[model samples]
Target: MPLAGPVALLAVPLGLVAFRGCSTCWVIGPTQTISSGRLERTCANGVCTLMKAGAAASPAATP
Candidate 1:
């Protein structure tokens, strides 16, 4: 039998969220860290920072 790729991927993320719900604090791209403890997705220069709750600058995102 073959494994379902989509299901497997989804399961991994879900499992992470479930197991490490609190410690897992990050995003995949640049972000504007809000005071409310949330990461806003954005791109800056050439790298994306999974910013904390309060990032210092709002650098421009590269295309």
Candidate 2:
């Protein structure tokens, strides 16, 4: 049909836009997991340090 050419032309641009948008979406999954894990570990370390420091200081302040 004569309409097939124009329809294909439109599909190409739409497909390209969709592909470009989704291309980076896959990368977020692994990176997000790794970064979140790193953040949690960093937060845990910070909390542990604070707790140790507070405990150490409490004994000195008591007497």
Candidate 3:
């Protein structure tokens, strides 16, 4: 087998492990933000709620 093939296959699992619990956030509009992933429980605005594992996003009421 070619060396490139093995390298490519190894990268897949490494990538998954590196980003397993990664979270990302996006600023939408002027005062709205959205986040996704397993590690996003709190944000800068302090209005986000803690979501249970496997649960969807559940934001707190905005003032």
Candidate 4:
């Protein structure tokens, strides 16, 4: 019983490192990206969607 106690303590960190390999196997969450050509854009989550100071792209579209 005394010998088993020391082994269990050492096994904890080893078990945690071993388990990390399989932890990222599942695609449980979404990976999203959004980009824009505008220069005044603000970025968040590795992407920029909103432009700054209302300075949008020139040449307004007409239909």
TM-score against truth, every candidate: 0.25, 0.29, 0.26, 0.30
lDDT for position 59 in model 1: 57
Q: Which stretches of candidate 3 lie over 4 Å from their true place?
A: 21-63
Residues 1-63, model 3: lDDT tens digits: 589998999897787787675333212432232243444464456666565447765565899
> Worst 10-residue stretch by lDDT in candidate 2?
49-58
As for lDDT, the candidate ahead, 1 or 3, is 1
Off by over 4 Å in 1: 1-3, 21-63
- lDDT at 55, model 2: 38
- Cα lDDT of candidate 2 equals 0.58
**TM-score, structure 1 vs. true:** 0.25
Error of 4 at 29 (Å): 20
Those runs of model 2 whose alpha carbons end farther than 4 Å from true positions after fitting are 21-63
TM for candidate 4 is: 0.30
Question: lDDT values of the candidates?
Answer: 0.60, 0.58, 0.58, 0.58
lDDT of 3 at 20: 75
The collision pairs in model 3 are: none
User: TM-score ranking from best to worst?
Assistant: 4, 2, 3, 1
Deviation in Å, model 3, residue 11 alpha carbon: 1.9
Clash pairs (backbone) in predicted model 4:
none
